[model samples]
Target: MKLFVKDLTVIDSSVLDYSRGIIGQSWLVDIVLHGDLNEQSMILDFGIVKKLIKSTVDELVDHKLIVPAHAKFCDVMSDGAFTYVDAWREHGESIHLACPDQAFALIPTEQITLASLETYLTEQLMLRLPNNVKQLDVKLREEKIDGAEYCYSHGLRKHLGNCQRIAHGHRSTIEILRNDERDSALELSWAERWKDIYLAEHCDMVSGSELSLSRAGMAALTPEHYCFKYQAPQGEFQLAIGKSIVEIMPTETTVENIAQYIADTLAKDCSDALTVFAYEGVGKGAIASA
Candidate 1:
């Protein structure tokens, strides 16, 4: 990690003011090195890095009573510096209006020191980005990994922390439908792979499910055996005698309604009555979009 800086580049303050209300308005100047991605580093996780930059910049602007241009200035150093540092002064107000190269005027210069900035910003971002961020070339490195790996906004994964993949994963925001214990049976209307399942009779005692039905058997049964009217016979039932671990001790035959039982059982396994409802809601919402 290395640093370089310059004065602010805002030629017009009115335009900046007009853009202030953007909820998550943020800006970063990526300092790219003439190099390639670190092969051994896997993917750069920008989740925490962005957070740290935000907090650090906020501290500089809001808390420290510094300006945005200045805030942006100091954030570069948070990523740490190696050799040469450059700042592309944004044509506006900055911490130090004039660099030593331009003119050698030495005074406090009305600019605040960045002593406490690093501690706070590093701490905030350390919670999310890779370790030793203080040593990385952040301005260039951080933005490149935005959709690569470790998106804190979403859960973590490799090659899939990307925005495209994130959209493919479960989204936390859709409206969840409300349901109850009474919704025991539902249409096994989706894929054959996802069958209508029921909560085990002794759900609390079961690790997951003692019943294991392969896609072949499930394919054989499906909407037919799972129909609300179908009933299991009076004798013992075995889904796969060929398999070593077979489903044992079948339930009462009066439990003729397999569909309702499956829906209700799925509800209990979720550990909440409305869980299946919420899950189904999300699934349907996804399909609607598709």
Candidate 2:
């Protein structure tokens, strides 16, 4: 017998990549189980499957930075309180970060992929399932929509909950309206700006001039790279990368703030009439207008 669940849950995460730096993504999950009928004449209880599988997925992957331990140009280390990660791009662009150990997952692989993640989840589920279960399957997928969606990463140091994790991120879709008419062009532009990008808090930025190396390197690098650090409820966190790849906001990076920032910024360049729909994940989000 086979039992299945569709649209099980959505996980927002970040993957460290040598070529793309840290890429944020959103994945929707589906699950299937093969087993003989249990005492209840069911392969598995739907309620139990929902509760058990959802909890497992959330505990392991949700709101975390997922990195591959064996990826080249990647180095990870840990002390008592924090996990330190160093990742370099193909061209030598790099990021050095430190956060609470609970903030990220160090998978035993060379890269992060749907197939690998599915395998890991299947293994975990197999261990937890009843003896009657003979096989488990996992399907990890991302939404397919042109320009409407994006994969991005961010940190919210001041947050009291899991958002305090510095490397966690989301895959979101954006919508924009100009003078109350849907503006696909404007929406696409904003999506492009944040695609695979990191959003940073302006107050947390460390001035390049303050660092001798950054100060010296600034002259040779266009747009320049900035390093930023902060302390959150989890622990200390750090992020260093090119300025062009980040959107440094004067306020927090919540969807509420993001919507307002987009509306306010576009109001200055185009017109005072604007509405921004900023989604943190699937289904619901925040809206702002000017």
Candidate 3:
């Protein structure tokens, strides 16, 4: 017997890429279980699938940084409670992060692609499944967005949950309305601006010497990078990313603030009212008008 669930959950994370540095991504998960029927004549209860499978996947990858441990340019280390990463781009630029151990999913792969993540997820899931389950299939796919969208990475230091992780991010779509009318051009413009970008707060910025990083991480810095570090309730977190790929905000980078920032920026250019829909990830987002 086979039981399946579509849209099981969405994972929002940042992945270290050999060429692109750190790229934020979001993927929808679909799951299938091949097993014999249990005493209730069911493969697995729908409620259990929602709770167990969804929660498991969330705990593993959501709101975290997914590092390809086997990548030639990626180096990972742990000091009991925290993980440190040094990922270099093909052209000499690099990204470095240090955070709590729970903030990363170090997959044993050369790259973090859909196929690789799915295989890793399936292997992990099987270990926790019931004995009757003979096989499991995991599918990770990006949402089919018909309009302007961009991948961005950020951290919310005030968040009490996993969102406090310094390097996790999202793939989000932007919608804009000018005088209450849809504005595709404006949407596309903002998307281009944020493509594979890191949105950060000015308060988080710090000098390279002030960062809490390993010797290797400190050695990887260049004039072209910006350093950020903070102490949240979870632990100390730090990141050094290339300056060209980051957008420093005067205020917090929460979705609410993002929407307000967009609306306020657009409002400056015209007398017409503007509304901005800024998404943190799939489905849910924040809206603001100015």
Candidate 4:
């Protein structure tokens, strides 16, 4: 027998890429189970699939930084409670992160792709599934957007949950309105500005001497990089990313603040009012007007 669920949940995360540095992403999940019928004449209850399967997948990867441990330019270490990662591009541009252990999913692969993640997740799900379940299939895919979208990585020290992790991020879309009229040009421009970027807080900036990275992480730094460190409720977090890939924000990087910032920026040169709809990921976001 086979049981399946589509649109299981969305995993919003940042992945360390050998060439692109840290890239944010959001993937919708679909799951299938191949198993014999249980005593209730069912493969698995729909409620259980939604609750158990969804929760498990979320706990494994949602709001975390996915690291390709086997990548040539990637290095990972742990001090039991926290994990430190150093990932670099071929030309030496790099990103470093130190956060609580729960903030990362160190997949055993050379690259973090849909195929790799699907295989990794399937193996993990099988271990926790019931005895009747003989096999599991997991599919991950990105949301289809007709308009402008971008990938960005950021941290919220004020968040009490997994969002506090310094390296987690999202793939987001932007909508701009000038005098209540849709402005596709403005949307595309902003998306281009933030492509594969890191949204950082000005307050989080720190000197290289004050960074909490490993020796190799510090060695990978160049003059063109910006370093940031902060202490959240979870633990001390640190990062070093190339300056060209970072956007320093005067305020927090929350979707509410992002929308307001866009509205305020557009308001400067506008003779009329403007509105901005900023999406953090799929289906949910914030709106602001000026």
lDDT of 3 by residue, 1-290 (tens): 89999999999999888877678898999999999999999888999988998899998899989999998898899999888899878887788888889889999998888999999889999988888899999999888888999999999999998889888899999999998898999999999999989989999999998887778999878788899999999988999999988999899889999899888888888788888999888988999999
lDDT per residue, candidate 4, 137-212, as tens digits? 8999999998999999999988898888888888988889888899999899889998999998899999988987
Local distance difference test, each candidate? 0.22, 0.81, 0.90, 0.89
- The alpha-carbon deviation from the true structure for residue 257 of candidate 3, after best TM-score superposition, in angstroms, is 0.5
TM-score of each: 0.17, 0.91, 0.97, 0.97
Tens-place lDDT digits, model 1, residues 195-272: 211112221122112322332332333221211111122111111111111111134211122223333444554554
Instruction: Give the local distance difference test score of model 3.
Output: 0.90
Instruction: State in Å the error of residue 14, model 4.
Output: 0.6
Compared with the true structure, the alpha-carbon lDDT of candidate 2 equals 0.81
The Cα error of candidate 1 at residue 144, in Å, is 22
Order the candidates by lDDT, highest first — what do you get? 3, 4, 2, 1
TM-score for predicted model 3 compared with the true structure: 0.97
Clashes of 4: 0
Runs off by more than 4 Å, candidate 2 = 207-224
Could you tell which candidate, 3 or 4, scores higher by lDDT?
Answer: 3
